[model samples]
Target: DIYAYGSTFRGGEVGVVIVNSGSSAHEISIGGLAVAVKAMGWLVTSNETSSSDPLSARGVMWNGQSSPQSFPLLSLGAYSASLSDDGVLIELPPYSAAGLVVYF
Candidate 1:
């Protein structure tokens, strides 16, 4: 199952949260905007969805990078894409969550 939540902020910025709870991947298209120029976001997920071990369950990655252990914060890799005429297309992996901001 896939769930999506979206909210429009000031200055024509739209924030979205997509959650994929099932074991299959899903591709979603978002449209109906006046004009969408770009989309950027981050994804959080673990290696496995079924693992119950404390370490495995607690381990999470931001945009496919492991958590940092020292200072000099880890650089979050942004997911950027140019919107098509139809809209912005997003792919969600199983048991993952994505936070995105769409700019107009």
Candidate 2:
């Protein structure tokens, strides 16, 4: 099961998601709602890990993918205008938890 919680402000939104299952990865979509995302942090239950490594998580795409071609995990921040209609896709590892802060 996937659990999510957050709030929206005049400038942006913030929230957290919990991935209960441990088999497949999950993706979240935020489309046509914002212009960019400032940052994100992740904590994997199985890995017992959580980090916001800027070097490794330069940014994220709307398609649930990360930028810099490789930095997509542990951190998130993307400032662009080519987001997909599918929205801002947030990749969630198995049995993990994440927090997101999006900007407009």
TM-score of each: 0.80, 0.46
Error of 2 at 99 (Å): 0.8
Clashing pairs in 2: 30-88, 59-77, 64-89
What is candidate 1's lDDT per residue for 45-88, written digit by digit as tens? 77655675323476676788775455353465588988877877
lDDT values, one for every candidate: 0.78, 0.50
User: lDDT score of model 1?
Assistant: 0.78
Best by TM-score: 1
Error of 2 at 38 (Å): 4.0
For model 1, the stretches where C-alpha displacement exceeds 4 angstroms are: 49-56, 70-74
RMSD of each: 2.9, 9.6
* CA deviation > 4 Å runs, candidate 2: 9-12, 36-39, 48-86
Candidate 2, residue 76: Cα displacement in angstroms equals: 12
Candidate 1 worst ten-residue window by lDDT: 47-56
